[model samples]
Target: MAIVALRAPLKDLAGGRSEVKVDGASVIDVLRALEAEHPRIVGWILDEQGRIRRHVNVFVNGELTREDAPLSADDRVQVLHSITGGTA
Candidate 1:
């Protein structure tokens, strides 16, 4: 199983759990596992077409990953929400 580390808002949605274990082979599978636990998370991480939202980033073992990125049993995944700001 891969350990998925959740960002603030995602963690909050997962009942304060910062990490979750997912037995999956790819990023999509991992996200599906997370969604299985916290149903509302799907909308937050994926778009209507089931693609990862542009505002969200996924990292596998400290490297950025795409939806098709493969996972290992000992791999660690981090799901983050992008924060953007501009000078006024």
Candidate 2:
């Protein structure tokens, strides 16, 4: 199982949990497991095409990674909401 840390609204959506334990072989799998537990988190992290949203960033062991990235029992995954701003 991997330790998934949810940030901001993601955590808010996940019943105010900061971290969750999920079993999966890859990032997507972990996400799926998480979604299974928290249905409201469905479209917040993944899109209709089952892809990570552009506004959402995922990191594995402190490094940015793709959805297909491999995972291990001891791995730590962080899901963050990207902040975007435009000059007035």
Candidate 3:
């Protein structure tokens, strides 16, 4: 199983659960497992069309991950709300 951390911005959407464990052999599989338990949370990470949102960032084992990054049972995943503020 892989541990996935949720960002604070979407805490409400996740029922206040900060972290979750998912079983999968790859990033896609882990995400699918999360979707099964908390379907609503899927939208928090993935877009309506099932694509990762630009404002959301994912890290695997403490490193940033690509869209098709590889994952394993021992990998750690974290979701972060990207810093988007800029000078006005």
Best by TM-score: 2
Off by over 4 Å in 2: 85-88
Q: What TM-score do all the candidates reach, one by one?
A: 0.90, 0.92, 0.80
Comparison by TM-score, 1 against 2, better one: 2
Candidate 1 similarity to native, TM-score: 0.90
> What range of 10 consecutive residues in model 1 has the weakest lDDT sum?
79-88
Worst 10 residues of 2 by lDDT: 79-88
Tens-digit lDDT track for model 3 on 2-88?
987886665555677888888887776787788888877777688677666777778898898855787877788887877863346
Model 1 residue 59 CA deviation in Å: 0.4
**Local distance difference test values of all predictions, in order:** 0.87, 0.92, 0.76
Q: Report lDDT (Cα) of residue 61, candidate 1.
A: 92
Q: Please list the residue runs of candidate 3 whose C-alpha ends up more than 4 Å from where it truly belongs after superposition.
A: 85-88
For candidate 2, give the lDDT.
Answer: 0.92
